[model samples]
Target: MNGKEALTPREFLRIADFFATNGYRLGPKIGEGTYSKVRIAERSNNGEFLAVKIIDKRIAKKSYVTKFLPRELEIAVLVKHPNVICTYEILHQGELVYIIMDYAERGDLLQLIQTCGGVSEKEAKRMFKEMAEAVKYLHNLGIAHRDLKCENILIMRDKRIALSDFGFSRLYLDQQHGDVTSKTYCGSRAYASPELLRGAPYDPRTNDVWSLGVILFIMICGKMPFDDRNLKLMLKKQMSEGVTVPETVKTQVSSECVRLVYQILDPNTDSRPGVVDILQSDWLN
Candidate 1:
């Protein structure tokens, strides 16, 4: 259906039927969102695993953006990279929309951080490198993963990282210069860039760098560098006072790494370094 159109009740039933025919044995719910619940599942033939993101068309049709679920699937399925969590199949039955994707057994980056009581200096750098590689791949495809928070970065069983969740991703035409200039404030408040919070034109790469900077800090410090009671205060702090890696962290990681973090999290997007700069940094390479 188009943005303005709605699916009928019969369409919803067909969507559910599609899943049953796909050989996906739905397991327990693993994640929940506004209109969907992600479930653990296995493909019947080879028993290869997958995560099934099932959304009720009825619930979505009545929600804001009523069309966001379908749009997200469309964009996600088009993006394929080794470091990116690939959307393998889409099953539309009745009023249900199902996205079957590779299952990351290790969960997300947040869980990995917690597993180590926060990552070590070496681990953080390695994680940063992997993340940079994935982001670079997306950028090359002319896609921007606007939401690059810890939760959106999944870790595979073998310890590799895969960027997931393309609900906020966008394709940047050459003329756009990679700017997320449109009025699209579409990510978690904690990781959002200043321009995003300020409601102005901004570059998505810089926005991603800002969030990655935060993740790097968290990985080393074992905590949020900026803690505020409210979103307003958080934005104020993020704008006025950029993160300062504690002296203790300096003992954990190199000065060059610290400098890299500061460069990325800089409140001003104009001065924020891009992924290329990060890849070229001694701390990264």
Candidate 2:
């Protein structure tokens, strides 16, 4: 499809006026989702290309924290990094919120794994490095990406990765660590840490490291380390037996890498290596 078909109803209306005053065309629908939709388009006047993510305004307005879309705008506006999805602009038309951002052709990491049947050792190492660096950067900025997962990690044109979706992120500016106890249980069941499962006091970094280990495990093995029909049983195994990096996976990944994964997946959050340890590992460095 051409550029016109790419623009959203509101974007089309706005662009229609601008085009009446100037010129351009919208391209084709590149991707879409339950909460939003994305498309590629070109500006007629300067031939500039752009990707737009459109969210329903009425729904956004009705969202508890996102009432009037300020929270989402805050997240989109504040987060910017080479390894983070870049939000270009936030536009409002009637009751809709449209966020314009850079488009990554490769989409999310889960799809990437599905295509390749899991990443090779070298590629997984490279991706792990990038993902760790991004996490480090966010932590330094006092941000904890509480909901990190394959679906939240997107692949860019250069094959580099970018972290997305800060809706569940927590910004901790104080140097002092907060209380370890968290009443609310968050994160995917498969990726949830032992502390989260136990409903105990938990630090963000500690839990994040566990989830990271799970991601790396999935990357190498093409499946989760803990596989059980029942969620409770699966978590019990993760807590008690620990996630076993299969023999085949161990062969593909370095011993150091496997060791590091073991270090991170330790059920005891207090004993799990912090971000620094993960970064300084031989596999990463």
Candidate 3:
């Protein structure tokens, strides 16, 4: 453990006291962030275990508390899908905001991928399908999971994928009633599309597709599609006919599966397939 905590021991005690009043008993620390920490909480009434993300508004940047925090709260309530993490309750007291959600005993997809060096093609197919379905559901609701990554994809007790961490999520449609152009630089650079890397205004939906492709590639190949160390070269490879997978690794996975990843990773946003196309892919079927 780093031993550095967002919440001091006293702060945790204060929050625990607050939750007790709301029929919850805070337990062990399960997760954390720069400005917040997640603890497992038990409901006093029914003994249901849930995760409470305690965000300290005092420590967090003003812009986050005023902007992203509100949108995240709104999106958490609106997003209701089997494959997505369920936010059961949201409570606030003074400078602390509490987001209580389903407690997934298992860790995230990234941890699973790293531990096993990657799963078999069949396993990848099952996991990716769930991830795609979650993204599809969010898009249908005019919500964009702008930060889709292995880390954000949680592993439930059943080992099913539950897309989580919607701090970067946004309701993307504009007044003209269409996907709006994005200039805000959000999400990890490793999972970003060519347009996002270029710092240009682009469609967030297709950008999301590119990120999904990256995750799928990592799941099957056990590594990233491009090395971000050389940004220029990575962008060059992404835009060309170069095969993303290593020659040695290519022989292990099926050509069809590789093709599907390549298609979704297309740098040309116009040609990039959406979450729906990915869900309907033959490999997934």
lDDT of 2 by residue, 153-243 (tens): 8888899999876655666454476544444466676787877777765677677788899899889889877764677897789877887
By lDDT, the best candidate is 3
Tens-digit lDDT string for candidate 1 (1-285): 333224466854554455557776666668767667787887778777789887666665453345445457767888877788989888766576778898999999888777877887777787789899889888877777888888888988888888988877777555646344546788886787887888876778778888888888888888876774587887888877777888978887889988888888899877888888889998986
Can you give the TM-score per candidate against the true fold? 0.88, 0.82, 0.94
Which candidate tops TM-score? 3
Model 1 lDDT-worst window of ten? 61-70
Residue 234, candidate 1: Cα error in Å is: 2.3
Task: Output the worst ten-in-a-row residue range by lDDT, candidate 3.
Answer: 1-10
* lDDT (tens digit, per residue) of candidate 3 on 153-240: 8998998889988888888988586657788888888898889888889888888888999999999888988888887777777778
lDDT per model vs. reference: 0.78, 0.73, 0.85
Query: Cα deviation in Å at residue 62, candidate 2?
Result: 5.0
Of models 1 and 2, which has the larger lDDT?
1
Q: After superposition, how far is residue 99 of candidate 2 from its true place, in Å?
A: 1.7
